[model samples]
Target chain A: MSGWTSVLVGDPRADRMVPKTGFTVQLTVFSSAAMAFLAVFALALSLATERLADRWSAELARTSTLRISAPQDQIAAQTEAALRVLQTTPGVGSARALSDDEQVALLEPWFGPDLPVASLPIPRLIEIVEIGDGFDATGLRARLQAEVPGAVLDDHTRWRAPLVAAADRLRSLGYISLALIGGAMAAMITLAAQAALSANSQVIRVMRLVGATDAFIAGAFVRRFTLRAFAGAGFGAAAGAAGIFFLPEADVAGGFLTGLGFEGLHWLWPLAIPPLAGTVAFVSTRTAAIRRLKEQS
Target chain B: MIELERVAYTYGGAELFADLSMTLAPGSFHFLTGPSGAGKTTLLKLCYGELIATSGMVRIFGQNTREMDRDQIALARRRIGVVHQDCQFLDHLPMAENVALPLTVSGRQEEADEYLADLLAWVGLSGQASQLPPQLSGGERQRAALARAVIMSPEVVIADEPTGNIDWEMSQRLLTLLVELNKMGKAVLIATHDLNLIRAAKTQVAARVLRLRGGQLQAAGSEL
Candidate 1:
């Protein structure tokens, strides 16, 4: 086109430090900016899932149950019998009936602090923690079913399986989202670069007439677009990182769902979004620029 | 050498020619003359590889135009130089850069520093090399265009309406330079409407005069 369009080297010599242009620089920048913003949430989601998984695994590792609900006169005797069985059982760490205060606290958020326990026949609650492979859940359940009648064993693995699987799926989904974002950034940058090239058709013809190769002409466009994308995404990422810093994170006693923000080593991961955006922009714009120039020839 | 066999070019459903043929040996000089809209510039473009013939064959240096890729066409173009009527240049660059463009594009910018300065001086615009194209007068621009065309020392030099925007004295000066290039073994093909300039060029060099009229090309009679 023109000398201005030829100033940027299309494909710089491998050993040379000269910068070259690629596919779609502006598109890359836009995609990077948008993706980087999304990537912050994905990364946070992944870290949160890992924590959720750990919490489920640790809390449910070795636990069983013994529920006792019988006739009002028989209730006291059955509770005592289940406690005696738990104390005598091998590998049992501890067995105790949950106190009224503990039960009230667990239900406080939903059912309020007060419960009409004397009017309604609420089943007695027991908590069991076991040591070293714990008591066999099936064996304990059979004994309680005969001796305590209303008693049931809960190893917690059934609920834990679904919870952990959901968390793991969320983590994988976050990674997939990050990949899609990167690809989208590349595609967007390429499109913007093509637009710029088309707009400068006269410049291209003049340059070609004067003997510049397609690579040289395309290089100029690629570099300009690449620089623009990198600079734009860098600004976007800085803003995103700053925004993440002020997000609300759940503290102690809150459910796993409330803790949806960055924690510990996870904070540093968001810092990499800017540079990753830049790399994607560079590659995408370069490819598009070269391809366009080749097609023009 | 350049050759055309029953060549024709069409644009926007308008026919410029149907059966035009011409040949130029090395070191030959020819003037293409026509009234306005006579396809003189179009014929010049065909002479170079800028526009391929719509039908028939146009060859440069014995290679068919159909066989040339962009790079091949560019390499072939390096052996030829073209000067447009408007003298297209990168307005952002100075006249020296403009004149040295052919060399620069050919990856021979290194040889331009001395040759370009000398060429600019020969064209009598040695003082204008550092100035931008827009800053130059019409006469000065024409001379710069001439310098740019010949800077590569190409085998063939094609000028389309080179002196159209300049005065008589300036036009004479440009013609003198073109004639000098012809003496240096460069085949010169100038497309113009000025018969007086053609008459003046014939005195300095043995030149052929061709006229494009009525969708056909013919050798002009020696009447001017």
Candidate 2:
């Protein structure tokens, strides 16, 4: 704990021992900023995809559709019989047959305006909402088969499963992208740190001759690089959050493209990127510094 | 105190020196004289825990160099001040900060603030405290290096060619400061090829002279 605190609250005199101006400084800051910007996008994508999966699963899982296809005279009788059966089921919350106007409106998107609901032999659709554990599909199907010969029940299991799985895979991909970004950032920072150490070999030799410990020497470089990374990452995260905030608002017509951003308290997540980048810098620089100092000895 | 027991050092595939034994006791002054590539600097490094002897033991302040980790060596180094021929310093830092570095590294910066002015004054570098190392003259840089070396008040002082780059006057001044340090009961070991400087030191303090040649260490007998 004291080590960590010292890394944060560095010794100014020791810090002054290292040259402040070098290409390695620019490299560390630039790479951290760029990676942090990319990380923000990855985090947002992961979270957005997760929310999409849950929303789709919940909305689709709670409701089902029953389609009735019969002789024109028997269609109403079969829909009513399906609705009646649904009403008596233990887990069925509500069931209603779509009126002609409602069915016309539902089909309008596919069939243009003023869809001819009465002229075509379109199947009568009854929407069923579930409650508690949800009604057993097999039992409902068996009863519907006995009471209504042309009725078929769809619990949305096939559609919901595939959609949720795809969304989950996308979320995993987003998280994997985040990991890759972090790894690439670490590699870049390590290279930059090694370059700085090599450039300041004289400084290190002087410090060592003056009885400076490896921890003291390493702490100087670690603190410098860590603060650089933290500052750069903070800037990058702020820019990214601003970019995300200004994105087009979520719209039903826009669908997936519109919903690809932070929602509500999720805005707080990107705040962690700066500290995480600082930590990565601290670990990578410290490891590289210690190893280099050992080799110098 | 530092003790070397039949210490041997090898560079690349060949042996540089072997069966080299020496002891640096408190308040003693010794001069190591050798030709170029005679392993004087390497021996000094071994004495300070910078390099471990390949085949023999080097004990600094009662701890074996082979047995000590890097941190332990570093801690032991705090008690042994070393002055390099090149007078190494952090070029970017001012002279005052560079001199105070020993104390800063040891977490004794407050003591530096107390005695730094006095230390610089002792070396006659009080006016050049804020100047960068690159701006200082050779003699001034050497003095600064001396100041830095002794700022920690180490028990033993090892200097490699302390007067190699300066004129006769500056060399004497530097020698006077080192002689004063010896008088204060700090062990001093100087490695140099300067016979005149050795003769000059002998008049001020009781000093032993050792010569290294052909991978052997021999005590000099009235050669100076």
Candidate 3:
């Protein structure tokens, strides 16, 4: 932090040694801002993906479905037997059979709502909500088979595995995108610093002849570039946050793409982008300036 | 004070000067003269620790320059003012700012106000203080460079062809300023091919003139 203060309130005399670089200043600021703006989206994506993965893992892991498929007259008897077994099982919080209307609503997207559910020999579904650690599917299956001959236990492993895996991959990709943005910012700033050093070779030689140390010379450049990055990234972060704020509400679409934004307190995360960009620029510019100054000496 | 003992310099497999030895004691005045490409500038550079000798030793203020790092060399330069032949200046800055550059670099910018005004007046550049280096004539620029070189009141002053671009009157004026600094106990070394300036300096102070020819330094005849 003290270093930041020094960079902001540098020795005015030292700053005078380096002339104002016109286009390089604009180039550094523009690129850093653009990178910071993109980084905000990457951060949002990573956070959103993480939230989705957690929801899928927690909701799916705790619940299972008991389906009874038997003759029309025996289905009710088997479903009743399955519920009785589930109630006595440890870790089973509650067991209730879904009504015909609820089942019809669930299948309305795949099948027409006007289907004759009563006339069809459809299987009965019993939703088993788990308590503490959730019931063991293997033990539950064995018990259901002995009690209700036509009952099947599904723990949702098949559905949850691929959804969670995809979410995890998306989260990792988001992080990689952030890393690439930071690396690109550093690379661009380094090149700009090198150009400024080369263009001001005469100033550097004169400074050296007048008894200025390499650190003093390098500080002038580092401070200028770091401040530019900070300001530019600040603007970029603001613009990015605004863009996210104005995005269509997640409830409007009820899709994954609509959820690709920051949640309540998560919005504070993008505020860090400016300082992080400033630090990157500071390190990159300092390294480049010192190396170039050493070479000249 | 500066000392060079058996100092040799080679650039691209070609020797500029070898076995060169000299010392500038306190309050001493010396002149280095040579024809074009005779290594006058190279010797000045060695005295100021700008270029390390290929062999032997060059010491400034009793410290061997070979052991000094870049920072140490910079600190040493603070005590040794140098005036190049071309009179380099930050072209964007005004004459007053350029003349106070040594003070500014040394973190003595506050002291610049008082001494800068007097130095500019001494160099007859008071009227051109606000003008940039590019706007100044050759004589004015040379004067400005001299003011900058002496802003720190360095113990030693090394000028390479200080009067190369100026007229006769301006050369004399620059020489008078160098003589005045020598009188004030500053070791002064001026490298020039102008024999008239060397003779003119001799009337003001006792100066040792050394000539460099065929890549060697030797005492010239007492022609002046």
Highest-scoring model, DockQ: 2
lDDT of 3 by residue, A108-179 (tens): 898988878999888999998999988888998998889999998988999999999999999999999999
Whichever of 1 and 3 has more lDDT, that candidate is 3
Poorly placed runs, candidate 1 (over 4 Å): A1-35, A46-66, A71-97, A114-121, A124-148, A157-191, A248-297, B103-116
DockQ, structure candidate 1: 0.26
| Candidates' C-alpha lDDT | 0.78, 0.93, 0.91
Q: Give the distance in Å from residue A183's predicted Cα in candidate 1 to where it truly belongs.
A: 5.7
TM-score of 1: 0.80
Task: Please list, in the order the candidates appear, how each scores on TM-score for chain B only.
Answer: 0.98, 0.99, 0.98
Once fitted onto the true fold, the runs of candidate 3 whose alpha carbons sit more than 4 angstroms away are: none
lDDT for position A88 in model 1:
81
lDDT (Cα, tens digit) per residue for candidate 1, span B1-224: 99999998998899988899999878899999988998988898888888889998999999998788777777887788888899887666778887887776666768987697688889999898789889999999999988888888889999999999999999999999999999998899999989899999988999999999987989999695
**Lowest lDDT 10-residue stretch of candidate 3 chain A:** A1-10
Model 3 reaches an interface RMSD of: 1.0
The local lDDT score (0 to 100) that residue A184 gets in candidate 1 is: 79
Q: Which candidate wins on lDDT?
A: 2
Residue-level lDDT tens digits of model 2 in A1-297: 276798888888889989999999889889999999999999999999999999999999999999999989999888888888999999999999989998889989899987777889999999999999999999989998999999989999988999999999999999999999999989999999999999999888888888889999999999999999999999899888888888888884478867889998999999999999999999999999999998998
TM-score to native of every candidate shown: 0.80, 0.97, 0.97
lDDT of 1 by residue, A193-273 (tens): 677667666556666666665555655565666556667767776667677676665775486666877777777887787
Query: Positional deviation of A40 in candidate 1, in angstroms?
Result: 3.5
The lDDT-based order of candidates, best leading, equals 2, 3, 1
The better candidate by DockQ, 1 or 2, is 2
